[model samples]
Target: MRKEETVDYHIKVVWHAISRMYNQGGAMKGITASSGFVLLNIDQDEGTPATKIAPLLGMESRSLTRMLKTMEETGLIYRERDTEDKRSVRIYLTEAGKKQRDFSRKAVIFFNDKVREAVSPKKLEAFFDVMTTIDNVIEENKNLDQKIQLIENE
Candidate 1:
């Protein structure tokens, strides 16, 4: 029942720590963690559809639209209209974006490497399995809301 014992609390605390670390590192390079993630999600060679980026990051389209606009103004990314479809757009990283994305990628790899150094592969696999199960439960709408609704119904 204690907050420290809750699954979400630990996940959130660790996530916030990671976010702060990423933000600090990214700030020096004139990008935020969010922007770096967007850059990484973009396809390097062919570009990625504008519509697909939001879902990949679990973000709303409106928020991504604003972020994309800022990225565009900063010369990190460019939008291209599809040749056959006027309404469809693709996002491509500029040289600067690619550089930042690489940095982000390296940071993530370094973090993972450190974790692997500290933890056994078996434990890491168990951790990943638990996280995946939690994600699947939430995605399937089998979380707290459903339990609360069921209690109310009864």
Candidate 2:
């Protein structure tokens, strides 16, 4: 296969692996693919705002609000008015949420260990570098949509 084809195939494989790991619950049932889980893992203690999490998760604020509300209803997380800024709401994991976070951490570790066992350290390092480069390029190109729209109006 060509280099580009190889890259595309590998990207798809990686995406599938991540989707399977997150979307498919292992021992725990009822857990679904959610930005809330990722946010909980990243900010176990720190309370993050809904606006802040939306950008980080590459989701719209409205979508995030709905997700948060669902998670809150599930008793996974809770929101409160920020002490410093009453207008801003901050999110934190409840006791149940913390247990879910722990389960997520263990599942991630297991999946990562399996991947590590399959790939050599050198290959893994190179893969990490390539993924980082791809992330950077995507972030840089995010503004291209606006540029293209501006040119189209000319």
Candidate 3:
């Protein structure tokens, strides 16, 4: 199939476009799309656990550690020892972090609102259904590479 016709190509292209848009919007706030995402995932009121943020953002702990350090240095976030679990750390947003998070939220909502206005509700529902199906297919094929390797040995 042509690259333009491939599902993965379209998904990747659209995601990159979205990322670029977010990065542009975040630039004004002195944040990148990634940092904005991290800020939003952190709970401002109660603080989120250090371990929990990585899974929420689908990031590796090492990458998050570096990002968190940068955020701390920038005065966007602070780390506190978990009171109940002394070994664990909790991440809380500073006032600056809250402002950035709000910006990210509004940007996301604006994008969604524009998309919703352009697409019919029925079409939007169909799109969501297709995305869900794609996720399920991926889960079902989790062992596909191993199975393919086994077949290749036969």
Instruction: State the local distance difference test value for candidate 2.
Output: 0.76
State residue 55's C-alpha deviation in candidate 3, in Å. 1.7
The lDDT of each candidate is 0.93, 0.76, 0.92
Candidate 1 lDDT, 1-61, residue by residue in tens: 9999999999999989988988998889998989988998999998999999999998999
TM-score of each: 0.90, 0.78, 0.88
When summed lDDT is taken over every stretch of 10 residues in candidate 1, the lowest stretch is 137-146
Q: Pairing residues by index, what is the TM-score of model 1?
A: 0.90
lDDT of 3 by residue, 70-130 (tens): 9999999999999999999999999988998999899989999999999999999999998
- Model 1 steric clash pairs: none
| Model 2 weakest lDDT span, ten residues long | 33-42
Worst 10 residues of 3 by lDDT: 130-139
Put down candidate 2 lDDT per residue, 37-134, tens digits, no spaces: 55454477777876688777667778877888888888888888989999998888888777787777777778789999999999999988998998
